[model samples]
Target chain A: MNGYLLAGTITGVVVGLVIAAVAMTFTKKNRKEKFTYDERQKTARGEGYKYAFFTLVIYNAAYGIIDMSLTKPWTENMTGMMIGVCLAILVHVVYCIWHECYFSMNEEPVKVLAFFGIISVINVIIAVIQGLHGELIENGMLTNNCANLIVAVMFGVILFALAVKGYVKKEAAEEEE
Target chain B: MKNLKLKAARAAMDLSQQELAGRVGVSRQTINAIEKGDYNPTINLCIAICRVLGKTLDELFWEE
Candidate 1:
């Protein structure tokens, strides 16, 4: 309703649009027109999802207990948003590790891990900036709600970039065979 | 330095990087990186390559 909220909303939407555009461009450039999931990739993804789900449940339970002890409710929007994004990132990291381990047995794992590390640092910087500017929360419940939205967008963008790079390398190898 | 010896050996066996990768259960880029000396393969991958090429590990991996 206020000017700050309006500005945060606009910023979040713009960031989301830019990230979506970039993802589309990468997918178009690298992948085949048809979509196909390799059996190995599927199995790895399934395993990763399982890890992510367990992580989310455990984190939520622990955080909920802590919040309750502090006289805070677990149903708050800000806490929910943080938990959701953290779980999403956990899932993605698990998937990346699985895919790399299965398909790139001879390749260094540090390369993919480094990429994720960089993205995480960037996300933290953004969150800190947004929080400092008071654009992320008011009264501890995400009055603006835009910073979390931007983080979700950025997560999707980074994941898409990783997928594109992986698929491109796979296609290049297939061509040589 | 480029791995001319590896490239030559692979050519002698009529194997592309993709074929070698398939035999070794790694991505082709891993094989390409090894051939270009951009990456060093693990001991397991080295042994796999030796097995596929029917050469001793030293013959396939050692630097002269």
Candidate 2:
């Protein structure tokens, strides 16, 4: 209905196509014993999913309890609350990717940084361009561009911190060996 | 069952973890985990490792 939905739909389609193509190509090749799933990766994936599921359950329960206490129906804004589920999925995906349990995506530090860096860059570019073009609602108690800027900065900081922590831990691990 | 014998056997054959993993069609982390006793590999993987190292199940996995 809006530009946001249109862009999201396009992005989703592109990503889905890429994923399907990769699956079709790799499934046959990987059917033979070619060193894919290892014990460590399997364990990591299991642990990641377990933790994510548990967290999601706790989150949903907390929200439900809060809704009951307030006597306000929570289903009125399902789209807003769905962000929690999206975040839970992000947590699981990040954990799996961190532990090298993801399908074919190596957990190289540079690659990880690059992936997050690209997201951050896109956010910043969009926000800045909107601001420069006078698209931001000026009365500013959190306009759309203002919100975009906040998200861009927040994710940028988080990504930077993750990259640093990963680098430090990797260095410490290498030093230990 | 840490399977040090498996590590030793692989080492005796002068194969790195990655190399042995390649031969057995598993990842190096799997080999490392098996050696470190952090993971219990399936029988199929055990057999594959044995075959690659020219070892038997009893020789590499059975603990005394």
Judging by TM-score against the true structure, name the best candidate.
2
Q: Highest lDDT: which candidate? A: 2
Q: What's the TM-score of every candidate structure?
A: 0.46, 0.63
Pairs of colliding residues, candidate 2: A35-B25
Q: What is the TM-score of candidate 2?
A: 0.63
Name the regions of candidate 1 deviating beyond 4 angstroms: A1-18, A27-35, A73-76, A101-128, A131-177, B1-13, B17-64
Question: In model 1, how large is the Cα lDDT of residue A40?
Answer: 41
lDDT (CA) per prediction: 0.62, 0.66
lDDT per residue as tens, model 1, A50-137: 7777877777787767767976453455446565666666566646543543323333334544544455567677777777888666
**Per-residue lDDT of model 2, residues A26-99, tens digit only:** 44433443324566687788888888898788888887787678654433333324535655665676676566
